[model samples]
Every structure is written in structure tokens, then in C-alpha cells.
Target chain A: MAGERSSMSEKLRVLVVDDEALVADFIADLVEEAGHEVIGIAATREKALEYLERSAIDLAILDIRLKGRLNGIDLAQATRAREIPHMFITGSGDPSTREAAEATGPLAILQKPFSQERLVSVLSQMAQRDHSLN
Target chain B: MRILFVDDDPDTRALAIRAVTHEFPNATIREAMDLTSLDEVLQERPPEILVTDFDLRWTDGIKIFDRVKAANPLCCTVMFTGTGNEELAVRALKHGFDDYVVKGSKQLRRLAITVRSAYERNNRLRELGESRDLVLKELYHRLHNNLQLVISLLRMTEKTLGHESDRQQIADLGRRIQALSALQEEFYRSEDFRRVNFSSFLERLARNLLETSGGRIELTAELNLVELPVDLAVPLGLIANEILNATLKHASPDDRPGHLSMRLEQIAETLILRISGDGAGSGEDPDTAKTGLGMRLIQRLATQIEGEVSLEHHAAGAAWQVSVPL
Candidate 1:
């Protein structure tokens, strides 16, 4: 089964959004290695909205605690409006922020210091679920 | 040196960052609401000295200082905790804490001032970092104001040349210089002390220029971005003022519209500003070889930033392109 899953095609299209450039790049690298195509990376809410409007990415990985005036809660609201699927990756698991993320329906919240393997597995699952829904 | 505040309350952390920064403005102050964050802040920006509280959720202040000592024995340590007992403070000092303070409402103000004064005295010798910045900031403002006064005097004397255009030009340039100086004064007065966010700054600059424009042209801007420092924001604001004045003066009333638009941009490190309008259909570019007061002011402001200016006259209107490297 693992071998069959590895050989599967129709590469997953992913968008990684994080304010920190290094974290965004790391997510992109991990996603690509998991047989998915990383489309683009955005560091701001405006840029991410633009990407969502124009692109056909299968799923997005949003970091909760962003640098700008808008945080993950704001981005999730935007995604919900468009009915886009997303999972959150955060350096923090604070109760308030976790509650906010949970109110947006079923979301996979992964704590920071996460490994590349964990990222690939979670994103791969999200991409597959999105594909089946579409 | 590093001062750490470990408490579950956000107020305490903020109070600590403010109080410690006030005491040793140059020293790196890091706070942790808990030990984990304290450890993280420490790992990122290590302070020369360490301070902690005895009562923490995950770890005690004693363990925190011991970790600090283990990481670097040279780091000075101070422990202050409200819930902690004397045994903890004694243990912390014995291990590595250079000083200890008890948190109490009774002696709160006294304890704070004491901690602050002690921190200042301990770091007084090598703590000239912020003092240097303060002196340099003072020097910058003094130079700018002196230059403005000199320019104002020259302008006042020049207006008496008895030529309408010369007097108008002199007054215009005078206002532009004054605007620049005012912006400099305001910038140093800001909390950040070096940058001006452009949206509100430009709005005020436009209002000031319109007041000085004698009600000829209505000024408006469609600003989309913010966050430019004093070096660029002040000159950009002045350049916009001068450009608007020149366009209004040179254009025929029938030929040009009563309003001009100034749009600014900050694309990464490159800042671009465009001033465009129907120059009363005269086809004359105000930003040209024919020198005038506004032209001279724009030139000076542009050269100050080592930027370039170009004049473009299209069918719809004329526009000035100003680009600078930040």
C-alpha cells in the first residue's frame, strides 16, 4: 500500500504561507519531496489572498502567528469564505489561539519543532481529501 | 546584560520590559511568562545578565539561574518572585544569583526603584550604547533646525527682491524647506525615532502645502503603502509639495485642472513617487532644465537621497518620476 501510494500521480498542488522566509522555504521543500508541487509562497495576508484568487492550489499551509496586522484567524476567515481547505502550522499552541483555530471546523493543528516527515504526511492527507472532494 | 521576568501575568512582563529598559536602555531585556518562553528568548537573544522569578509553572527560578550558569557562568543573575520563599532566594543566590528581590505590594515601588538603580550602577561602565544613540539623535535634529533657520533667513531676505515670480518662488521654497525641517523634528520626536509611516505624514504635508498654495489647486493623494524612514519620507513629502506648487503656478488656469494627484509607492527597498496632472495643456514640464524655486528645491531633495527625477509628458497629462534607494 505504501508503495502504491508513493507511485500515485496527479501531483498535489500546495501553497505555503509564512512570514518567516526560512519556514516558508522549508515547507515548500518538504511538500515537493512528498511528490507534491509547491505552487508559490506568500508572506502577507494580501499576497496570500491574491494567490487564492488566481491559483488552483489543492491546499494551503498557513502559519497561525504571522508578522503583519492579520493573523491566521483572519486568513482562515478568508479561506472559509472561499470554501478553501487549510491546515495550520504554528510555533505556539496557546489555548486561545487553539480555540480560535478549532472554531473554524475540523482543522489539523500541528505544533512547532515539527519534522519534515510530519509536515509531508499532514499536507499529503489534506491534498488527497481536497482532491476527492473536488 | 539580560533581565528576565517570569510570571503568568502579561502586565508583569510588560512592566518588566519597560522598567528594565528604562533602567538600562542599552541592556537586552527579555521576558518569559513561563520558563519555556524564557528559555526560548534566551536562546534567541542572549542577555549578558539573567533575572528570573522563583515561582514558575514548568520550572523554578533556581533551575533557571542554574541553567543560565551552566550555559555561561559569566552571566550575572537576579531572582525576584512574589510566591517564592526565602529558602528559594537564598538557594538562587548561593548558586549564581548576584542579587535577589522580594515582590510585595508594600515595598513594590521601593523594590522597583532599587532594582532599576542597581541594574544601572552595575552596567554603567560599559552601557554607553544607548547614550551614544541619544547624543547622535540630538546632533541630527540640531543640525537640521539650524539649517532650516539659515534657509528661512535667506528666503525672507530674497522675497524683498521685488519680483513677483522671484518672491513667490522664494516663499514657496521657504515653505518646502520648513516642511522638511518640521518633518525631521517630528521624526526624532516619534517613539521609533527614525521612520515615518507615510499615509498620515503625507496627508498632513498635503494639507500644509494646500494651505500655502493660496487655494489655486486642490491637493489629493491615493497612498497605498506605509513604513518609510525619515531619510526618505521627509524629502519625499517636500518633493511632492514643491512639485505640486510648480505645476499649479506654471499651468494656465484654463489649460490645467484645479487639482493634482500625488501617488507614492514603497516597492521593497525602492521607493517611487509620481506627481502627475494636466499642466493647463501648455506642454511645459515643470521638472526641466529651466530652473525655478520649486525646481531647485526638488533637485536638492533628490540629490540628498542620491535619487533621480525624470519628466514625462504624455497626451493625458505630465508626470514626474522620482525614484530613490533606501
Candidate 2:
């Protein structure tokens, strides 16, 4: 049953949002490599919000700092309000930023540039949790 | 050493002069029988040691002590009284009197010894203060140099990552490390070695950030002068850096010139900091805006120092206000 549940979550749709195109693409690749589907890539809060409304995103990787007026943190909060599981991908490892991110109860904060191993492991853990919830 | 004896009674004054003179034969001794003569003697030549009767007919002996101590902080004082008790002894000692001698043959013999020891102790105190200052200065100097080395390493790494997508991230870390180095330099430059003139620090930091950005934005700062402890200054400086980073990143378009302003002042029991920029105010929801790295950092900094943070968005700009307990 656990193996079947894991396989189901492995195909979960994930959304990636970051202002930097290269970083966003890199994160999407990591998500895809982890046996998850990349549903969309959003550069700003508006774009990310629109994707959330139009797509069935099971999980998200958001950047805390984005290019537009609305940042990744805002997107994370929006995802949280909808009870969507998410994590933050940020270059800032500042203690204060970590503290704030922790308050939002994210699955994990993926420090940029993305590490393939860490990203895969974190996604596996999240997928396991998502399956168990079902 | 030169000694001065001030007493109301002629016999006691003469006896004091004889005792001090006999104890140190090479010493110069002056005598004053009343307040009037005490002033004259002090004006002519200030003595290294002042031995006075605590109770005088015209005035209290504290007057003489105050005059001498005010003139030379290092001057040793020995109060001699015919009617002094433990209370008077305690009172005199508390008011900077080095030693006190009650009117007796034995105590008078010890007067000379007391004066000698008093000067010796004062000399030792001055020496200790100077040595402590020297050690602290050297410690901060070494710390500053070591922090600079770390910054250099970070910079070298940043340079090698130019083609990488994460090069900007490395550069950001370098900037924070450089801020730490700047903090160490402030300690090295400060006379006290523990406190910083924060207004000057903020000014230098803002100008450095602007210069690094190639002067794309105009910054105006209205800061009140304040001396802050190292603990408060370090985190506060980082918060300022993060805020400045946000303004530089979001406040203006790349092709247009922008304006940034920062103000820090103390009002009553609280310190207020306002960092604002005349950029397009993103009409984003506050809950989402609060999650920005810069915003979270500002909030975290405020939390560390027991402060409150508020965000404001106007048609012209957006502002962050942090109020901390001073």
C-alpha cells in the first residue's frame, strides 16, 4: 500500500515560481527529475496566482524574493491559504529570513542555487507525506 | 612631594606641618590657619597632598577637598580631625578622601605613610586603566584584520563564479560579510572600542551601497547621532543593509533614476527607523508582502531587539517602519 501511495504522489503536479528564469528552470528540472510533473513556472505573484487558479498544482517551490511587486513569500502565503504543500527556494540563508519562513510552516527552504541531491530527497520526503495523508 | 596643612587651630596646624616635614625632610610644606589663607596657599602652589581638619570654625573640610580634587583629580587627600568618629570617617572616605587621621600622636605618625600609599594606589589605578585600553585596542585590531581576510576569501570565490547563475547569490553573501568587516573597523576606530557612533556608520554604509550600485539611486538620510552597543549595532546594520537592498531591487525601473530615504531617531523610550523609496508601490496583499526575504529580515531584526515593524504603501512609494526599545 505504501509503495502504491508513493507512486501516486511521484506523479504529483508541482509549480515553480522565481523571478530569475534560469533559477526557475533549474528548480523545475529538479522537480521533474524527482519523478514529479512541473505544471507551470511563474515569475511574479500575478502569474503564480493565475496558474494556481487554472491548474491543479499538488505542490509548489516558491522564491522569497521575486522580480515583481509581489514576491515568492507572498505566493507561499497564498499557497498556504489554499492548504497547498509548498517550500521556499531562496539564495538568502539569513537567520532572520529562515525564522520568517519557518513561521509559514513550509516543507523546507531550498537554498539556491539548487542542489540536485537535496532537492530530490526533500521532494521524496514530501511525496511520502502527501501519500500518507491520502 | 609637596603637602598642605589646613586647620583652624594654630597649634594643630603647626603640629601637622612639623609631622609632614619631619617624615619627608625634602618635602615642601605649606600651612593655612583658616579658609582665607587656604585659598591664598592653593592659588600660590597646589600641593600633591592636602591634609585638612574635617571640622573647621569657618567651613567644613569638604570645601578644601572639593577645591583640590577639582583642580587635580590625582591629588591625594588625608582628613585630620580632633572630633571625628566612624561616621565622619565613612563620610569622608565616600567623598574621595583617601585617608583620615583622628587627632592623636599615633595617627599623626601614620599621616605621612597614608599620603605615600595614597599616591602609590592612584598611580597603580592610572596604569591599569591605560593597559586595559591598550589590550582592548589590539584585540579589536586583530579581529578587524581577520574579518577582512574572510571577506577577501568570499570575494575571490564570487569572482570565480561570474558565469554561474548563482553568482549574484555569492555576491550578496560577500556584501553581508563586508558589512561585518566594516563593523570591526568601526570598533578599531572608536576610542572606547565598544560603542559606535551609529549615525556616521549608517551614513558610510548607505553611501557605500549607493556607490556599489553605480549611483543608480539618490539616497537622503536624516539620522540623529547615537552611540550604540556592539550587539545592537551589528544586527541593526544588517537590517539596514537588507532594507537598502530591497529599495535598490524593487524601488525603481532599471532605466530611470530613483530616490531612497532612511531616517533614524529616538522618540521618548523608543528608537524609530524608516526606510522608504519612491518606487512603484506593489499593491500586493500585506500577508504576501510580509513574506519577502527583505521584509522577513526586517521583522526578524525588529524581533531580536524587541521592536515593532509596520509597512506602508503610498501612491508615490512604499515604506518600512521599525520601532525598537532604546
Give me the TM-scores of chain B across the candidates: 0.53, 0.75
Q: CA shift at B141, candidate 1, in angstroms?
A: 9.4
| Cα lDDT of model 2 by residue, B116-204, tens digit | 78768877988999898667644653454344345445545655775764676666675676566556556555766679887787787
Model 2 chain B: which ten-residue window has the lowest total lDDT? B140-149
> lDDT by residue for model 1 over A30-56, one digit each (tens)?
687777887789898888888877777
* DockQ of all predictions against the true structure, Cα-based: 0.01, 0.01
Model 2 ranges with Cα > 4 A deviation = A1-134, B8-10, B21-47, B55-63, B82-91, B164-167, B181-200, B213-220, B224-231, B249-257, B279-296
Worst 10 residues of 1 chain B by lDDT: B281-290
Tell me candidate 2's TM-score on chain B.
0.75
Residue-by-residue lDDT tens digits, candidate 1, B253-315: 653345677788778877788777664542245455357546677789899988888877676
